[model samples]
Target: MQLTQSSSVEIPMNDAKEVDSVTLEPVDSQSGMDGGLKAWLTVVGGWIAGFCTFGAANSFGVYQALYTLEGTSSASNISWIGSLQLCLIFAMGILTGKLFDAGYFHHMQIAGMLLYVFSHFLLSP
Candidate 1:
């Protein structure tokens, strides 16, 4: 049974054949990888995202400090906010990358934008 994105893939590490089943065999790399407007835009978008995510990750220290100063909670409880942010970023990366591979780019992109805006809206309080 071929496992696809729509179908749950149960990969057993002990089974080499199952691992091989998941590998994407390369085909016509030039058709996709050759430089073009879309390729360059993707590179630019990736660079922007890399810089922004790095900045956001680093900004957790700032948030930690702010929370500490605000006296909203103890250091221990406040730390969970940053930890949750980091965890969600990693988890979403895994989910959304798979979605992108499965041709859900537009839906994921819009949902991401809405979620980002909603987060900011919630934080504004």
Candidate 2:
């Protein structure tokens, strides 16, 4: 019943003419399946990232209104900016997903935060 390296089992068929062979390997018990502190931390970090990114993007209407009131830009032009922001968010999600699958999640996370902060600094007068 115990499976180890290169361990295989054979089962006899009802007709006793053919046998089916199956190979089994022992599953790693500690392959990050504990769902403990690390899992919860990752969940919370994702929630925070979503809040910072999506939250600001979704609130573009307020910014657009302010811009319109200040007469800095036309309503249509301001709306276009909001649309572009949403599109970039979606497009970047695809790129980021690829990087995540490639195991550069921590690097991307750090780079994203730095970029976010740097952008805010550039935007500040």
Prediction RMSDs, each to the true structure = 11.6, 6.7
Error of 1 at 39 (Å): 1.3
Q: What is the number of backbone collisions in each predicted candidate, taken in the order shown?
A: 0, 0
Score candidate 2 by TM-score against the native. Answer: 0.69
lDDT of 2 by residue, 1-125 (tens): 65564565554456555555444555566664668898899899889988999998888888888888989889999899889988998999889898999999899989988988897686443
Top candidate (TM-score): 2
TM values, all candidates: 0.65, 0.69
Compared with the true structure, all predictions reach lDDT values of 0.75, 0.80
What is residue 121's positional error in candidate 1, in angstroms? 2.1
Candidate 2: where are CA atoms >4 Å away? 1-34
Rate residue 87 of model 1 by lDDT. 88
Tens-place lDDT per residue, model 1, 1-125, is 67554455544466675354453444454567567798899999989877877677768777778778989888899788888988888888887888889999889778877887787687652
